[model samples]
Target: MPAESNMSTHSDPQSSETAFLEMRDVVAGYGNTTVLHDINIGVENGQIACLIGPNGSGKSTLMKSIYGFADVKSGTITVNENDITGRSPQENLMAGMSYVLQDASVFPQMTVHENMLMGGYVFDDDSQAARRAEELYDEFPILGDIRNQNAGTLSGGQRRLLELARALMVDPEIMMLDEPSIGLEPRFIEDVFDRIKQLNNLGTTILLVEQNAQKGLSVADRGFVLASGEIKFTGTGTELLNNDEIGRLYLGG
Candidate 1:
């Protein structure tokens, strides 16, 4: 892994002692569609927990609920022990949470700096946001060097890195990443996962939804396998990885 970045704790270690975040029985979907059923998930203050499964397993749907993009019909979503279910994205940001979707989360026409500034939208002062952006850039030097460059021009891997950096502007405690490694080449996939593992090491509780099951589980401290909007298995990465049935079923043997 690259040098570890500063940890992003879900709660200020000096100020609180609570689980960073929690999603209890989250059921969400399109209008009357109800794709996610009784989904329960959590991310500890400084750990990486991943969800992996075949496509159409409500992975993205659950992510949307956590980020307040989709309506969570029945369940509680909390951050630092405060209820956040059904809150808007803006509200979630104010609560010190960040979300990075699989697509279009980055402003194509904006410079990397501009994109990071938007991450700190809750802040009213440009200088403070800029300083936070600079701190993020420092965490990802490859992104820092191109901070002023148009985000649309970056390579796929670079753009993903930019999104991760931008999500850190609030110095978020739990950074929910939806498909963090989507659409990247094999080499870059390793690079991205390495960075994610590094983020976990830095104490950022990451709740990741990934299509690449094998790779996602390899780096996770814990893993869940979702099927048809419900959790079918939950275990440490190694436990799931060693399960012969899981290896053959999801990891493609």
Candidate 2:
């Protein structure tokens, strides 16, 4: 394993004590290859926390580990004070967590309404799913206008919007977003960031893995820097952005 970055934690101790989501001393990875080392991070209720680092810094792997897609070698992951390490994705969803994957994840052949319905498939009743779909339509008018159109016909930004809308069908309390702004035009990228802010305002605790470090930190309540599969820094977003060494090393200052 590589040496961990020498950085101090700047998290508010009180906030961490009451954090709704937390990973403590985690070591995780894919089959037989450890990628994360003694990692720790936390997000208070309804706060937007961003993970920013160089490529292969275990950012996505942390999210994957939380969602049970990666193998956890040790440590614990918790939500609302409940242990959820190694829970299946479906179990996590039922526990009020939702994960929005990278790239376009909609069913391209399905109509907008169909794709939305699929998001609520976990509901036991089809009628409940339909009601949730209607609620999402009201929340996203563009989706309503194109409810019958094929998902593949939409532009990149629109498809991204659709993915976000579908993810909301469950009204998850905690949302994990992986590269929400990837492949988007400048205008669309700004729009997506605005949407993410809107979602956070509506009380969804957000854990974001973004390539746009500056923009991501701008919207984040807390920021974490991962290097060599370990946390190099943890602090309020502004602290990291303004810190001389952190800014020069990670934010391309």
Best by lDDT: 2
Q: Which ten residues in a row have the lowest lDDT in candidate 1?
A: 2-11
Give a tens-digit lDDT track for model 2, residues 1-253.
1212332553324235688998888899999999999987888998999999999899999999999999999998889999999999999988778899986799999999999999898999989989999987887888999999999899888898888888888899999999999999988999899889988888899999998899999999888988889988887777677777777778887
Instruction: Work out the TM-score per prediction.
Output: 0.88, 0.94
How good is model 2 by TM-score? 0.94
Which pairs clash (backbone N, Cα, C closer than 3 Å) in model 1? 7-202
> Where is model 1 more than 4 Å wrong at Cα?
1-19
Q: Tell how far residue 29 is off in model 2, in angstroms.
A: 0.4
What candidate 2 gets wrong by more than 4 Å, as runs, is 1-15
